[model samples]
Target: MRQNRHITSNVGDGASGAVAAPPARPADQERTNSPGLALGAKAAGLPIAGLAALLSARIVTDELGLAGYALFALITTLPALLPLGDLGAGAALLDAVAADDGSPRARAHTRGTLISGARMLNLAGAAVAATGLVLAGTGTHTWLLGTAATPSAGACVAVAGVLIGCTLPLGLGASALAAIDRYHVALLLQAAGSAAGFGLVVVAAGLDAHAAVYCAGPLAGQCAAGAAALALAARALGMPMLRTVAASVRPGQQGTRIMHLAGPMTVIYTTSALTYGTDRLVLGHTTSAAAVAVYSAGAQLYRPAAALLSSAALPLWGRYVQRRGAGGGTPRGELARLVAWFAGAALVVGGGLVACGPPVADWMLHGEAPVGPGLMAAFGLLILVHAVNHPVGMWLSDAPGLRFQARGAVAMTAVSLALSVPLAIALGPAGPVLASALAFAVCVAVPCHRRAFRHG
Candidate 1:
């Protein structure tokens, strides 16, 4: 889902979904300068903020021990896997907003329509998640962590579902901010929300709160963050939030078209979720909760580094969309520069992690979660592969290239699933990382890069 913010788009020339070249304009200068600063802010803010959250999580995990930390991880993972929750409407709304060229009144109406539809879809997602949690609680489905389905855990899952449902609409707000080129604000709000959530967890741990109580911290913080973002977006747009919601109930032609773009995106996102998220599910089902803790702990080290790199690349989406709309050709030199930067960053970070990650992991996990050097090295390599591939993937996100990218993603997901099972069983926690790294190289990185370069 974090990747979704930085990738995917529907904005292009109406014909062929490729932007026709446009005459140089003043707005282009603004576009050029603004995105650079925004990207820098995101690159700096996300990792710093993510580190804070990660540290807090480390504290909570240490306090709670392996089983308790696993429960927390399980609660967090549930809402992430519910692909239908937003019904692809947020992505659609982003496209619609980015491409909108209408009178203020007209644009507001379209925004309202899109917002309403997205809200409904998110509500549906929340409902489905809640129902699933209820079923899991009642033993109608397998427990996520293989724990005895206790009444308390069931109650906690229900609460988490409700929180997830509430957060769904907030994603639209963040997307709206991005569409309007308020990327910094969107990123800041996200960072602030994460920090708040981390603080809550840290405080809860300090008080020796139960795992369920600790779980509530993240959900509550997310809700707060979402509300703040929605308020800010509404204020910026000069539209009442309630009126926007009302307007969305009656979608116009544009709203319908947005959904058209969203359909395939939904599938893309679903497969992506399966590809990236299956590791935890596999670990939960096939191994113990403690195994999940160990794997997730090691994996957590990779996330901030990835987030930092991804943030730098994310601004390219807006820039590319603008260029595509102007009918510009691929910026092969710029792409090369980005790829080089990512590759260099990967070498530095991956090398450092390979050298230092074991001690850090041991310290964070407090010996309760054992992360070997081999696991650290594998995780570092995984990060390297993803970093190198991400910019190329983002470059290929325009409509003309989207279908091919989707196919590649599907293939990657299949390979990831196929390999995850054997590797997980054979290698324990590091198995999924190795499997995903291989899948990306074979199914996504190679094909996408080759196609991207050829097209360029």
Candidate 2:
């Protein structure tokens, strides 16, 4: 049976089938930022921080040339896939701790699970690091990297593997903070880390450091931020990572149950990674590292706007749950309102890309960029499709809804993969974006419209 109540409590994830207990107590509430502050800060922070990271990325691409840019672009994608490293241990850990009711039995169970989960996460990290080692030591570099795969590029890949391994358990610590209602603290640290990492990247690139060092600059920032966050969270939760236990590093029944609950969510993450994150790799293998450079130029423009607009689902989704939960009916016009907001975002972001993209691409890439009207149009449509589709997807909040979302995700993935390679071969950089936009619109968006409007 589905047991973790927080899965539903976190509506942005489209979890359902459980009602949260009332909000935390006053002292408990004081531990985290107020919802207003959290919401408003994200409103301002996401864009600013995204820009900082984008600038750093542009610098990396500019300094690195096509080969370096390809490797850097590929490295940037590692963090997105990090959530999968633990095989659901982190989620299970969050569920176990968040449900704690201050009773001794609950405390013991939470501790054991936390310790075991932490250890599992650590092992998962080491395994990931080993995988990086294998990659570094092997000759199959072209399997994932761009056409400019070099020995140093392999070293950078190993650096990414090590970076991921270190970050995984630290991520667990951040999740622990969230479980205890200290999410804002984690967010603040994250933002600071991004800002700091940008400075570091600029300095290192200016110094003309070696390829591996400069390429791994962002991961270094991540490690520092993660370590700091873990330290703070450990102090708050009184659970030091890897040092607080005599218990065996094995999950008990509770761990198994939480992992089971985490299965569908894992699938959701996997499908998203496959569909949205594989475009660069496809370009690398099917075309050239130069293609990755061109595509990333366009991606840098649209991704921020798409990410910002798509994030609206988090807040809007809660309003739906609150109103519907209170009235025992569908929300009044929330879907329409959200869809309209998304469409507007599409116009501003997508339209701007079409009109101003060429000059901006040239500026960011530090040379004459050859992006055409067709590619810009594809980027616009991709943004519009994702912007509108995200809210509708977030609106589903039940067992069946969850199942439907998973099915849609699977369909979208299949469609994207089926088309991305051949299409990339035919259409160049625009192919994967077009494939994603088409798949999402047809498979996910169409069905979501049926369930969200007419069927309901």
Off by over 4 Å in 2: 1-39, 46-51, 81-120, 173-187, 228-256, 315-332, 397-399, 452-456
lDDT of each: 0.66, 0.66
Clashes of 1: 7
Candidate 2 C-alpha lDDT tens digits along 44-154: 666556766668767776677656766776776676644464555555555556556544566555555666566666777788888888987885655767575766777
Candidate 2: C-alpha RMSD after superposition: 6.6
Which predicted model would earn the best TM-score? Answer: 1
List the candidate 1 regions with Cα displacement exceeding 4 Å. Answer: 1-26, 46-48, 101-113, 140-142, 147-151, 206-208, 241-254
By summed lDDT, which 10 consecutive residues of candidate 1 come out lowest?
1-10
TM-score for each candidate, following the candidate numbering: 0.84, 0.78
Give RMSD to native, each candidate: 6.5, 6.6
